[model samples]
Target: MSQDLLFQLNGVSKSFVKGKEEISIFSDLNLTIERGDFVAIMGPSGSGKTTLLNMLGGVDQPSGGEVSFDGARVDNLSESALTRWRAHNIGFIFQFYNLMPMLNAARNVELPLLLTKLSKAQRRKNVETALALVGLSDRAKHMPSEMSGGQQQRVAIARAIVSDPKLLLCDEPTGDLDRTTADEILEMLQLLNRDHGKTIVMVTHDPAAAKYANRTLHLDKGKFVQRELVA
Candidate 1:
């Protein structure tokens, strides 16, 4: 592995037992992601893009081989350990924003910190910082339903980064937005990757969204078949 390597997967494989047979998602997959890199995983559905992402974020274990992040063996960790590690090191953003409709933006962003020992004041400060970073500081008290789709997504982004996680995993972050709003969200992600040195791995089918990344990996049949450079 290189000095900058952030994630390493060696001989990784995943399969499910289907009735009387095994369905292999991927086999003998070896991949590396570098720190501070903005990477996009692009492939058709059922190509194991999200499965790979789940493994990277410690959500799923590989059936064989090792999944390592920052030199730590993620696949080998116990369930509790994995949960703790993910809470500390990984930030997740999904298609639906995943914010609680009842809570305002600041409280939603503060959710992750609730698991920590941070004081309420500290959590509020972190929430403020994250919202400011996403240019949504003014919307701190607005509920999810009160904001536009784009604004809600921005709040979701703020929530993800509040803890300063080492990796940000976004699954179709702009899938629910209009073209213009999607572009804006993508631009903010680009800024986080370029200006703030955030290492991000996003799974997106949109070619336009993938273009924001520094590199794109095309996955097929449990392997990365092509690598495209965008930056």
Candidate 2:
């Protein structure tokens, strides 16, 4: 595999056993994601978009075939190993800002660093840097409930990046925000990819949200139906 390739899903398949029936979601699906690239995945409900994202992040494994990250096989890892790998290599953003209401912005952002061996002072420095990057430095002391939707999402983004993960897997990151705020968040994501070299894979249903990415792919009925390149 090329060093530039961040993710590869080769002949991947997934299925669930529903009351004696084996329901297949996808079969022989293949994908490749390169470093520093921003890609958006659009699909209808039950089309396996989120499943594919989870597979990429090692949150879920393919029932068949290979899932590789940075040239290493991820699908075969044990749960403990996968957890450690995800902590170091994957940052995740969700439609809802999954922040702990009791924790302030800085503390929320610092949660990821607690998994590492970094000192308290270093962790605080990293948290400050992340909050600053997301333009939330001034709101670091605020609780989640105290901030606007957009600001809370920014804090979530800060938390995601605080660990300096190699990949960001976002699932409808701006889905809960208003149009203007969504655009602001999208532009921030664009800046992350363009200027900060953060490779991002976002799954969104909205066409406008997909436009922010450099490349977009549509999935339907467990297969990629079309792909578009954004200028």
User: Which candidate wins on TM-score?
Assistant: 2
What residue pairs clash in candidate 2, if any at all? none
Error (Å) of candidate 2 at residue 231 is 2.5
Residue 31, candidate 2: how far off, in angstroms? 0.2
* Per-residue lDDT over 1-231 for candidate 2, one digit per residue giving the tens place of the 0 to 100 score: 688998888999999999999999999999999999999999999999999998888888899999888998999999999999999999999899899999999999999999999999999999999999999999999999999999999999999999999999999999999999999999999999999999999999999999999999898988999988984
lDDT of model 2 at residue 186?
A: 97
Whole-model lDDT per candidate: 0.93, 0.94
Alpha-carbon shift of residue 123 in model 1 (angstroms):
1.1
lDDT of 1 by residue, 141-229 (tens): 99999999999999999999999999999999998999999999999999998898899999999999999999999998788999878
Give the CA lDDT, 0 to 100, for residue 56 in model 2.
Answer: 87
- Cα RMSD for candidates in order: 0.9, 0.7
Q: Where is model 1 more than 4 Å wrong at Cα?
A: none
